[model samples]
Target: MVGAVHSLGGQEIPLRDPADFLSLVQRGPSYLVREWLFLAYAVFAVGEGVGLYYLTRPARSIALWALVAFSAGILIGIVQDAAVVAFVRQFPSDYAAADAMTRRALEPLARTVVAIIDVQQAVANVLLGVGGALYSVAILRTGVASRWFGLLGVPAAVASVFFGVVTAAAPRLSELQAVAEYAFGLVVLWDLGAAIVMLGFRDDARQDGHANSPRHRGDRPAA
Candidate 1:
């Protein structure tokens, strides 16, 4: 693979032409290889979602379910990016001088892509927002092992849902995607914070000991 690429300095970098890089899937052998690579990536993504479900399952049902919904969104996105986009990008688009038949053939693909984009925005963003919000609520209700789970999770989640709706309608707004990325980033940080908080919790035996300690025993009020 290293030798295949036309890297600079140390090695050769692959695809000297920008067009080759852009239409990589339309090419031959490389396209087949990328398909396998993407399949592997999709598998890894599934594993990650399952791991998340396992960890959050112990929380309230709201959190467990929210995470599941969020994972669905992520999977949809993976399929679109890894499979659908690759397949769709292979179609030729420069139809200005093409005959009527060629132009007619291209229009269907264009419409399909726009439709996919509309669905893609909702599944990839909206569900994430709803799930993140519920997970945060679960954390707050359960008292995360650490202090407050930050003040931004709810806000970010709300933004994520809002962006999802707007993006689905507009579909072509590139800036909206960037905004959703930022909102989703915060949601990710919230999850990390939760994991860290849980990691700091003491073992069951230690918690039992603390409960039975003389200080706590003496401090106990009437039943």
Candidate 2:
């Protein structure tokens, strides 16, 4: 739960420094709260993907792919979150009581865990970007939401994937990783916008021969 730029007092803790990471892990309750929130987000994202697939059913294949991508990302994220939570709960106290030599031995293991988490999170971000892009295309093709709304997601998705790749390729770019964190906000905003459009403008889809916006066009009865 510690950020890319977490500072203890005036000292900024470098990312994945075992000593600092172990120190922060002692704040187990805080870490648990953050991880639980992440879990909640993962659940919400999956539900949202299902709803989007339903709404954009005219683009059935695209929507289905989008849903798959999102769900896959969420699955990886859940595993990553669970790993950190388990590590925090089980290891910090032991690290605290361990002798210097024991701590040295544990540092490599701790760093490996952090590396794994970084890669998992990066892959998750890339998958989320792919999902967002696909879903945006579905929205555009189906006329289920404003074109501008769909357009907004394209660049955001690109930025997300770009930074995600950078993070995975070079985990040392903490600044870019921080930017990557903000990049997700754009995806979140798109989700909020899409929800509002779905709720408030459900009837709008009917204007452009999109009466089947929420249903597959092929399902319509012949006149």
Candidate 1 residue-wise lDDT at 123: 65
Q: What is the lDDT of candidate 2?
A: 0.71
TM-scores for all candidates? 0.54, 0.77
Error of 2 at 43 (Å): 1.7
Q: Which stretches of candidate 1 lie over 4 Å from their true place?
A: 1-58, 92-104, 145-151, 171-182, 191-223
Cα deviation at 90, candidate 2, in Å, is: 2.3
User: Which 10-residue window of candidate 1 scores lowest in summed lDDT?
Assistant: 6-15
* Local accuracy of candidate 2 as per-residue lDDT tens digits, 34-150: 556666776677767777777777898999999899778778877876776676666677778888899888877877777787688779878978988998899889887789988
| lDDT tens per residue, model 1, 1-223 | 3213522111111233334333432343444454455446444545444544444455758767877877877677576555444543444335344577876675565556646755775667687677667666665665543325635558867877877776676545654655654565565566566555444543554788988887878875557
lDDT of all predictions, in order shown? 0.56, 0.71
- Report residue 139 deviation for candidate 1 (angstroms): 1.4
lDDT of 2 at 158: 87
